[model samples]
Target: MLESYLQVAEVMFMQVRLKAFIIFCVYTCAKFLVKRKCEFKPFKMLCEFGWILTVLLILKITGITTGDFGTTSVFDGNVQISFNISIENFSIATLLNLILFIPFGFFSAGVLKKLRSKWIYGILIGLIFSLTVEFLQTFIGRFVELEDVLMNTMGAFIGYEIMVLVIKLKDRMKMGALKVE
Candidate 1:
């Protein structure tokens, strides 16, 4: 009981400090891939992030942060197996995991212009940023698996790439229609 409480406290500390940097790094990457000027709503990104974090916070407080929150894993000889999630849970939790990184990706691509296109740089920064968070979480009794870090980073990269593809396609279509006209 005492250990759990201590862990919670530590996780809370890491969450508060590391979340912002990770968002910033991801946003930088996202900008390179997304050129659509959301000039109309400058605060949209901030508001969106705020809402996500707030909702997640509520869920965390309510003890529903993640589907794999309370499961134990055992090493069976050469492999490790987890007993925390059901089939339904596996889907929801994995979906949640992917969704969790979307905002960070958006911020990196759409907001921070300095780190755009240079995906290697952006990903490295994000990875280091995430690693720090995971390290902090580890001491706090949170799941500090590298797989989560890899997934989050991959999600950010994929989201950024998708944005880039969208922008390029939009530009191409506009050009093609202009040529025909």
Candidate 2:
């Protein structure tokens, strides 16, 4: 038992292939460019993907999503993996995936603000980005789970709301005081 665990740990920490790292780099950078309208720094997304990819690499190294990557399942013989979290394994990776995409929605709202003021637009933006990621993952041999899409979009919506509320609060505070005589 201990030997199996040790083997998994050793496998998981091995240097991630340059090809995989580059793939993540290109993908994350492309998303950064798409959200460029707001003129905000892309620094946040750098950190976001840095952490996200790190988690993914770690999972891959450890073989957590082993035995065939897809949205399928069977109790015996066949093994399956879900991109989303399960009731039993409420782990850090699940939280990180949800947390990492918040900036995508928040800054995306900044981009959308130039066109229109709509929270639904933010939601749409989140869903689109997440769907793109999820679908891309399917090609990359990761499970594409709808449950992950829902949680990721929900996170985006929350991020968008926070940004909107902050702007509103700032406006209100400014309007309430310090009039020029």
lDDT of 2 by residue, 1-181 (tens): 5466546545654555454467657866777689765434464454444444544553453244443544433324243346554668755555655665675566555445541287687678778867766655554355567667776788777777876776678677777765632
Instruction: Find the 10 residues in a row with the least total lDDT in model 2.
Output: 72-81
Model 1 lowest lDDT segment of ten: 70-79
* 86: Cα error in model 1, Å: 16
Candidate 1 backbone clash number: 10
Give one digit per residue, the lDDT tens place, for model 1 in 53-164. 5334423532344434322322223223233444444444454455555545655555455556676745764566456555444333455555656656666566556555
Candidate with maximal TM-score: 2
Error of 1 at 66 (Å): 14
lDDT of each: 0.52, 0.59
- On lDDT, the leading prediction is 2
Error of 2 at 39 (Å): 10
Report backbone clashes per prediction: 10, 2
